[model samples]
Target: MEASKRQETARAPALPWTVRFQIFGLVAAASVAQRLNGTVNRSFFSLVDRHVRASARPDKFGVRSDDVDVDASRGLWARVFKPSEAQSPLPVVVYFHGGGFALLSAASVPYDNMCRRFCRELGAVVLSVNYRLAPEHRYPAAYDDGVDVLGYLEKNRLQDPAVQVDLSACFVAGDSAGGNIAHHVAQRWTAAKSKSIRLAGTILVQPFFGGEERTESERRLEGVAPIVNMRRSDWSWRAFLPEGADRNHRAAHLTSENADLAEGFPPAMVVIGGFDPEKDWQRRYADLLQQKGKAVQVVEFPEAIHGFFLFPKLPDAGNLVKEIKAFMDKSKASASSA
Candidate 1:
């Protein structure tokens, strides 16, 4: 890790003057928004996302993507990415994007581009789920939408017979708030014992989880880490959790001593950022899974901060892609053997 860190520092390029200036202004605005209510901050953040968002371009990295409907009446839809010349029966990854569960969407520039990279590099199809957001549709809405997407997949097709996908090889994955949704969705899906779709595993990248008690990491990294800080994190929890609910709610707090797992919860790969304020809680979640005798893998990026996976130029981001591919392959083999 030390060598990788040194190499990354040597190779990482500096941001252009214009981009740096834009970042400076954005950060300044955020500093002010932090004092306002979560709703206003959410609106401001959404505007920023709309301005920088990349559209659904299919040809990037030889991966073709299109909008797929799940339940248009409820405004539930997703973006599907399929790599060129993909072999039949390839693994399918259902991905959820991170925005503290209140901001950002599947169409957000970074997430769209990241899914394209996953399709090309991993040689698999990626379904970027656009689950309903919080405050507007709080609590079980996102989680329910997640399970609904699986249900939709079971009944529908990729619409391309040339490139068949293995539903049995299906995997649920997400980053940040999406990661939290991924875990709950997997639990519900597995509990139902859906014979049509087998959840091979889950990939949680810097998953968002919290509790009433602040961990050492949270207190120490409060204002140091970028994007995710103590104040904004708390606001997100309030918005996403049920009304009048506190951080200790079951949805936000999954590390309770008596927390229970679904009977067939799949294997998990937990990514940790050393500099992230939530690392302590992330570690606790992984520990709970391990204590239950679940097959879990913890991948840590020592110098990485929160939301590190969203940046492509970062060495850690590329390394994470490789790690995800390895986990998919290993989990697939294990599932087949079982």
Candidate 2:
């Protein structure tokens, strides 16, 4: 009954200069195309994406990754990361990256770095999916890819001595649109009654959810947040949603009073950032899951921005990784007890 009862704002330190420079460049790519049409300038932004490279060798954190094809014909693949010094079968996190469903990939530098952190810190295996983007491969495309990866996990093994994964404690995790996709993926996976992987829980880092009517946070922080503004948010919805569909479509408008979750929907971890305009929607989603009788954990980063988990310069990013580890441990404990 009370959404405003959360933590007060606690501003993290100013972003490092290197991060500021990248943010300014990304803003250029996104801001320039607003005048032309209701679309993103992917060509310009692709330059920034080029630097999101992946390597198969172990990095400083002792995590190594390699890209594995899930379905080459459809350009569906996943970057798999695991600890180099694997001592046991670790939980597998099926990670989907954020780009408003129309941009970025698992190969992106920030995502790659984050996945490595997940592997090294949590002692887990990460399967970061490179699902197809929207305005080209719209609604259900990414969802389909998300589900298919589970099928791949069921039939395939890491086939490497260094990587040992435990599908019994699998998790669907993502940020922004990918978080939305993670929710639906879990929904679809649970609905089908597949025993391929046991979904212990889901981790939604500032999930991107919206409707035709804006929430209070959206109005209050419309331009205050650095990356997202009203224009960009609307454009992302237009590009990702089905042609001619409004924001009220089931995918975007997820917090209806009657939003139907499957009977066995797993527990969830919802991350919120005060500076994110979408913060209210994320809270509504947690409320919805609770109303539906699913267990929920809410983590607050009062002064953080959208996609803050992607950059390590922000203290909240490290804090998020620790929260994820604790959530996973709790989920596994609950599953074992159940």
Candidate 3:
């Protein structure tokens, strides 16, 4: 029996480099800390944060950035990026960063690079929001922060002299958990019937959403994705959601029953990675939006994985940006005609 087990072990396939590195970091953290505790988790993620920050080589070619506090009481802030050469007021993109609702920051290296790219490529002012994270501030806190940032932008546009923003051309965008927040924020904005700023469109990049029932893609890609897996995603849901709430919560998971919330949503661009476990649900949401008569565009990157936008070197990353630009331009034209 032992000899057979050894033979089976030897025949097992090797994990991908990304998975191996992730496991190695977790193992090293456990070994060095002598225990698996919150402190160790934070320490390990901090190292990852540092690494990501280091890799963020800012491309400020045609863009200039500035930091501003949106609401000090709520500890909300944003890093605003504007195209330097644009003489006229440009559209605004209020962006949120993805970290499973518990990790990453708007000021992180990847997010900074993303904001810079959006500013330069779209010729727009990108307001990358820094909302409070969860496990410290639960569910609705992040959602409320998103709405607050929009309100602040609408009311205080003239205060920032660095960039002239066209409120009529405003849009909200985010990746992963940020995408989830953007969805909720758009709903809130539409519900409020605010005429101060019209949301021309929304871009959801690999939005992180799930439900009590497992998705087919989730089952198929359970342990497959290099960075995100079933276990990690489940942990994030538990950590960020309100206590006693399950994945079925409307805010956490978008279902057909509540699809009405998307009825008045601005034109949307839903970007999904084929290899992502969340792909099924993201696609479903896009279809729901389309069915509701909302103008929606679905862009899929068959070779990409979750959070692929962070890696600008990937071919799909540039294509995703171009898709966003096209969507924005279409929305802009529609808004003008309307």
Best by TM-score: 2
Model 3 Cα lDDT, one tens digit per residue, 1-338: 97685344233223456655654564344334322232225565656564232222334385667778888887888888876545678999999898778777877777887788888888888889899987778889999999999888888984545457899999999999999999999989988888889999999999888888888777766656556767666667777787878888887777678756634579889998877888888988888787777888889887677877777756788998899999999999999998
Stretch of 10 with least lDDT, candidate 3: 31-40
Q: Whole-model lDDT, candidate 1? A: 0.83
**Whole-model lDDT per candidate:** 0.83, 0.84, 0.78
Candidate closer to the true structure by TM-score (higher is better), 1 or 3: 1
Worst 10 residues of 1 by lDDT: 6-15
Residue pairs clashing in model 1 are none
> Residues 1-338, candidate 1, lDDT per residue (tens digit)?
97685344333234446544554555565555444555645566655565223334448466777888899999999888886555567889999998778777888777888898998888788999999987688999999999999998888857586577889899999999999999999989998989998999999999999999998778766655566778888888888898899999989788646467877899999999877889988999999899988889999998676777776656789999999999999999999899
Expressed as tens digits, the lDDT of each residue in 67-167 for candidate 2 is 89999999999999977767678899999999888888898888888888888888888999999987788898999999999889878966667567788
- In model 2, the clashing pairs are 52-109
**Candidate 1: segments with Cα more than 4 A from true spot:** 1-35, 41-43, 51-60, 256-258
Question: What are the runs in model 3 whose C-alpha is more than 4 Å off?
Answer: 1-40, 51-60, 158-162
lDDT over C-alpha atoms for residue 229 of model 3: 69
TM-score of every model versus the real structure? 0.89, 0.93, 0.86
Q: Which is better, 2 or 3, measured by lDDT?
A: 2
